[model samples]
Target: MNNVDEDNALVNFEDDQADDLDTSLAVDRFRDAVLYGTDWTVRTLLQQIEQGNIDLSPDFQRRDAWSLRNKSRFIESVALQLPIPQIVLAERKEQRGTYIVLDGKQRLLTLAQFAGDFPDDHPLWDESRKVASLRLSGLRVLTDLNGKTYNDFTSLPDLAQMRTQFDNHTIRSALIRNWPDEDYLYEVFIRLNTGSVRLSPQELRQAMKPGPFTAFLSIKSAESVTIQKILGLSAPDFRMRDVDLLLRLIAFSTRLSVYRGNLKQFLDETHEFYNANWGVEQKGMEGLLKRLEDGLIFLCAAFGNERHVGRRYKGDNFESPLNRAVLDVQIASALDENVRRAVEEGRLDLLGTFQKMSINDQEFAQAVAGTTKSITAIRTRYNSWRAALEGVIGQPVQMPELPNG
Candidate 1:
């Protein structure tokens, strides 16, 4: 939850959909619930327990697989005088019996997952620990404010007697419509998923990527299996965050930066670019990748020779500027001239030496702290490095590629 929430902002799913409902007359009533009232999805809670993942016990293999400590905190906070998530009907109607969950899957799932009616893995399902069961037990369906009480599904008069008769209470039914289309479903999913634990765009990208990518993960897992056994370790965490860095690098490398949408779209466009350009002929992308790889390799060589190594390549911070030089190479390449001159000349190595040179030989022992590093100085240093790299690599520096007029 903590990891997922960092990059996303909360979206009010209920408020957005209040005006759009299936029924005309019930619109205001629904609006009242969406706007001022709360109609807890009785069905969602029931479904959650049925899904069989509410085991808080440690021994349970599936206990909090998604790491929902924040969710527990939110629920506890709401219960024990903390600000609760404002009830939002982050759900919408589609066809029937299956509502398009607009914004509240996490909350609904939490409710169902924490309902203390049954043991973690209850047999016979006898003890109903789901929220629906708990909510229905003392079910005094809060009636509408104007006049009548037993208005909608909640305020039925016989529900009290029904609860008294049975040790359990269940919703008679829910009034929601089902929706198809994964994209539409995702929109609803995202809209409804609004909360403090708002998922990152990359997280959403991971969740929404289609079969091939998912299969790639599985294949990678199998490949990593032998590696783990040999090394007695696990795979590295290189998901959307890494992808974001890679995308920026690629964008900068390609000298194109217009395609900015969700992670899915970004990746899709990147893949398309590779397929159309690199994968097909190996002329454009191959050169780009090779130049990037060689530049880094040359940069590393220069760094080692100059006794300035070990700093990792951060794509955005350092590589972005270097990408400008790459764009320069691309321009030189278009002109059919000496390209990749920076890498050939070991410009980055010179820059690294320059940076190290700025600090005292005694102060070099200290980490990169208490130093005023300016962008202009960095650029100047890069130019110095570029001059050196150009001298060594013998490639002409060029600019970013633009559309031919």
Candidate 2:
């Protein structure tokens, strides 16, 4: 395929929703044990923020995802004594005294930023960085407080009275006490974190889920210098895209054939299975990571800098997404005796063999780079590539068809 075709294919599965749920899959039902904590004043929460009793997992929460308007609107809601959403906290099992935010982080963060020196991102945050001079924007019902900061009161009595009211404003809170494990917490977070806007799959996974697998992914993603370079990503991706990519790798490498149409659903399914069987699957998961590294080494040896990965094309648009889709399939299908042995020995003459397969095998290209989610595309590519790879390496091997996408 030409660059134009590759470009089109680069968008493979951009908005692809997996086929409907598989009926045979098990249903997960859970009821969490939660402590409905007593009502809290705004002063109490602000004090907690100052004392660092509330721990916002910096890895997950550092993105300034909320806009300034979002901050202003929320602040106005609190200022007007509106009934705000209850704050949700997961009492950290390890950190005996601290809490990790499970929901309403934006609310807490907005309040903290508002009360302190004005964050330049805020609407009232002028060049001087003073929040005391703040003004409310888009205040509908509380128009009297508009264009006035806490320090803008002309009368001392009025200022003290308003300050007392603001400080005494109540914030209801719920505590997820005594979570059995990180897995349960993660599930709860996923269930509640969705508001009008949804959280990303990876973000949901990391929020409260504690497990060997997710923990390992977090550690590996942060330390994966080589993996990041191979996949053409910046190391220590704060947004956790690399971690998301890792999940996709694990999902596709192990579960490609059974892939229902929806990527998120497939991932959620994978998450449930892994969390349930992590003790048994941990060794195998490690092996998959090793094989992935081997696969990347093989690809770089075979394709050099033209990895067909990354967002921007060196000679093509970012095929990182496409490259991942293809690579996962290839690794999972590497059951052929010859291919397996080559990978085991670390001496696969990948460049010569890949070139020959590309030249002599037209179907190979189509299968590798066609419509990404078609069953035909999934089945034909793996089978054809296996055949071509084996032929160039000299073997006729039998392998199962790749599962549905």
Worst 10 residues of 2 by lDDT: 1-10
Note the residue pairs that clash in candidate 2. Answer: 18-261, 18-262, 19-261, 182-210, 257-403, 310-320, 311-318, 313-316
Candidate 1 residues lying further than 4 Å off, grouped into runs, are 1-38, 41-69, 78-83, 86-209, 214-241, 247-268, 271-392, 396-405
lDDT of 2 by residue, 1-405 (tens): 011122332232322222212123223323445566768888788777666577544454333345555666777777668898899887777776578777777677667655643335543232224323335566677676666665553345656666676678899898877766545655565567444332344765665465667767777666665555654444444345567767877777677667755555677778777877999998988887876766655555445553443222222233444344455544553434567676457556554555555556666555555345556666765676676666655666544445654
Q: What lDDT does each candidate get?
A: 0.33, 0.58
TM-score of each: 0.35, 0.51
Residue ranges of candidate 2 with Cα displaced over 4 Å: 1-55, 58-200, 208-210, 309-322, 333-337, 340-371, 396-401
lDDT of candidate 1 over 206-248, digit per residue (tens): 3333234332322332333221221122332222222332333
For candidate 1, the lDDT comes to 0.33
